[model samples]
Target chain A: MPMNEIWNRRLKKYQSMLLRYSKYILNDHFVLALLFFAGGLGLAYSNFVRNLPQKAFWWEQPILIIILFLLLHVGKLASLLEEADKIFLLPKDYQMKDYLKLALKHSTLVSCATQLICMLVLAPFILRGLQWSFGMWCTLLVVQCLLKLSCLTLVVTSAYDTNVKQFLQQFCFRLTLLIVLAVGLYLNLILSLLFSLILAVVTNYFFNKASQRHVFKWNDVVVYEKGRLMTLYRFINMFTDVPQIVGQTKRRKIFDFLLRSTSGNIYLFLYSRSFIRQSSFSGLFLRLLFLAGIIIFFSPNYLFSLLIACLFLYLIGIQLFGLYLTFEDNVFTHIYPIDESQQSFAFKKLLRKILLLAWIILNVIAVAKPLFKVEYLLIPVISLGEIYLITGIFLRNYIKKNT
Target chain B: MTLKINGLVGGYSRIPVLKDISFEVNSGQLVGLIGLNGAGKSTTINHIIGLLEPQKGNITIDDIKLKDNPKAYKGKLAYMPEMPVLYQELTLKEHLELTIMAYNLDPADTWKRANELLKTFRLDNKLDWFPANFSKGMRQKVMIVCAFMTKAQVYVIDEPFLGLDPLATRDLLNLVDTEKKRGAAILMSTHVLSTAQEYCDYFVLLHQGKIRAQGDLEELRSIFNDKQASLTDIYLGMTQDGHANE
Candidate 1:
């Protein structure tokens, strides 16, 4: 069997997964929010651009170069290589080079597309702030895409040459990309484009040499692909559940003080520690809390702020309902002599505590704003009532339904 | 008898894996549960720990059924599963603390015993580390420490010696001995026949979810008509006969 066919199969499956999840990600409310946000930002950006100084600002070139450099790091080589592929495809080691070529081609297309979109966003600033001609802007875009290509090539090359110092290799590639872009923005645009093309060629040549010199490092390549996919899945997990992204854990030693009061209670002890350390739960909580906080802080009316606060509180409450089942499969949870009723009670207590904190922070932000109308008092009161509704009848119904 | 299962019939689902299984572990006794793969050892342990309900019969601790008083029944028992299941987010210290609270043991006294066990297992320094991130052997050690730390009246340890090192193996045996002398009833399921032969006071050999023979070593040797046979030889002989007819 040809390796290209295998690569094709994986790529198709990966794209289909992304397509299915995109429906969840770009749902109606999210799209509406995005439209409003983008429209508001665009209006502000155009206004700022219209009022630009007659001459180039001193930091314009530096800022443009830095922003453009950061955008280049947006994408990487999507190998679409699963862990099982190493074992199942071991006999096709001779055909791996061909498989990798297909992977590189797909990665280059994706990275270039991302670069193009980012360049389009920066078009107004580049064209107006720096007073560049369309031709020059297009040339800079080409230079950015080429730099991205160079980055992707270096990644693919490292997969073959496993002996190299990975950190140094990546650092040097980044440095080269920075220097090349800095030249394009600061000096001759056409000359920098030439340098970027050369960099891409040199990296591709190194990839050829590495692949020729080394045998197929199946484990390293699979690990590299998994790391890249996990990063993507983590980003998607912010929107909806991605079963592939197991929540990561961190020992936030500073948060020990917050867990002190939960000493005697078994479920509270487990739930609180899990919320703080497991990235998925805490990350979702903070994201919704602050996202709603920002939107409320800038709301034109108290009603909108209240709506946003209530909506996010519901979202966070429902999202964290998952934490209840985290220990369901562990036999110790069942075997522990603690009363089974204590689990639901302890979980509700924890949820109330979490939602109450969000309520206080959101209300504080809402009240701290300069609005002093007596009706404005209703924001905190209504949201306080929302907290009760969520913790009282809402949580009970949820527990009943789920259990 | 401190722990007793009377004519227990249970499995994961409708079809039973353990059939008419009856056993008793008296106080201050160690019963080695001998079985091959899929020999219903885990199913028995599960029933004792109340993860699986007995389809037909009942399991009781100190003559009290789990159905009658679950809190008291579970409070009197400690279980160490063959595969260690740990909360990925909890520290080793938190795990031990959770166990103490779960069993409602006195923290002051339990912590003292827990500290000794931790040092014995060389996990004293890793209290703040997540035991889930530990090596297989160290995780098994954490399970051991958690189970024995409860100082419960009856302990159900499943394949307890699978991943332990030689030094840890010795330490575990000594710990078990101490617990036994304190009148704890231990029912251990393991494949290490030699160690079981040396330490266990009784043997319950199970084949295909049914007890073929059970007694002390000499009694087992007499049943097989081989007075000089080690437990391993007797076990092999048991399994060979189990497949001979099939």
Candidate 2:
């Protein structure tokens, strides 16, 4: 096939995949909008970083940024891998080489678009601090990105080929790049250019070799890709903005004691059990624990107290909402003749109790930290929030009941 | 009390799998629902169990409308899905405990019946085993034990014979007999018409998502003019007639 035709075909394939993804990743239109808004906010944040004084080393901020990107990278890879495994499109393998070439192009475009955007946003501060010209910075940034792309490509190829040598090659190249980058930053512009050129050439050589060495192992590719996608999916799910796949897992048995004394309807009993057993709900608990851990670690002073409380409550709120949605999946529930009105009511009560318990535990822990004071005012606010949540749940249930 | 479903129209999605399905099983009877693959036999059970909503009509169990009051109706019925739905995290005991909790049986009765069921189903040795390690037959037995544990007013069982050993099947049949004598209705769906023939007091032959014929063995026998003929013979004749129409 002609290059244009291949490109068109590949584009069509990607568009279809994106359409399927829109069902989960972009299932809620508001979430899609939030992702865009987050991207914009990210750009603005990056711009702000660039405007920071050159002397401001900003190690913590940059480290945090890298960690954020790492999480997102893992998530994106996981989602991609998951989709690839769903249906192998094995018939398309008749022209496997062409398809792979097109796929490599597609992967490169996506990877570069994201990395370049970040590099560009950080370019001003980075260039000024390093005493480099705009042209030099752009060149270095482009070359650095190519190296990053090559490393990613190498990982993908190695994972596909089941090649041990690629792992060694990847580790060696990354180490070399890091050493050269550190030296070049302190050295002359020409030295930096030389280093970038060397890195880029080495990256290109390895990437080309890796790409050419491909032996198609469909299941290996699918599994590796799925593993990657699931990791990212799990991370992206943490954000209120991103709609990631919420998988079911078996819940711990410690909560069964609560199920013993059942006063509510039978549906309530079943719903409560589901709430406790469902993986999605447990994930909410973990997320709250994680958020709490982070807050404790930071320990921002009293001036930022309310803001911290607001953030804590917000995170808890998201967790509670996740608990509600855990039962909403069309798995066993849809097939069972469950009374929707009763289910909703039961779910509301169950969630309210859970939220109250979680809040008390988390709040008490937070206040125990010497840096933070326990404010009586926020307790009422929190109580009111819980009440409101319960009320809203019932109201939503009524709407569903009526509809 | 009898379980009755009339004009049940529903399926997975817009593709209607079950069409105007209606059937009945009086208390103290072992009823078999037989059909070919994709014959909507399971769909009928789903409607009766209150799983799938009838786009066109309603179901009543013991004169209680399923649509009007599902929890009450559901309380009277215990369903065993085609493929057993077991909680992997839960042990066999936990599974029974959860069921007992859902059914809201008296604590004493729950424990008493649970122990009796465990012994009867030969799951006494596997009380602590997680269902993840259990074989297919064992899983089916677990589901059966859970349903039978409830000893509800009615049992809507789907494909109970799929993964059962001969002994387990015999035990299940015996259990069904016991439930029947206790005035509890049993509505079972299966493709093994012959296996069901000996136990089922009545048979409802579903073809292409509709009930073709239903009655005691004599009534079904006269319809095919195959007196002393097995249910397999009658079912084959009915389906041949159904296909000829199609």
lDDT of 2 at A368: 59
The ten-residue window of minimal lDDT in model 2 chain A covers A71-80
Give lDDT: candidate 2, residue B150: 82
lDDT by residue for model 1 (A240-263), tens: 778775547999999999999998
Q: What is the number of backbone collisions in each predicted candidate, taken in the order shown?
A: 0, 7
- Name every residue pair that clashes in candidate 2: A74-A232, A75-A232, A78-A228, A78-A229, A79-A229, A81-A225, A337-B50
Q: Which tens-of-lDDT digit does each residue in A205-260 have in candidate 2? A: 65456556555556766676666555555654555423545434464567768877
Alpha carbon lDDT at A116, candidate 2? 73
Q: Pick the candidate with the highest TM-score.
A: 1
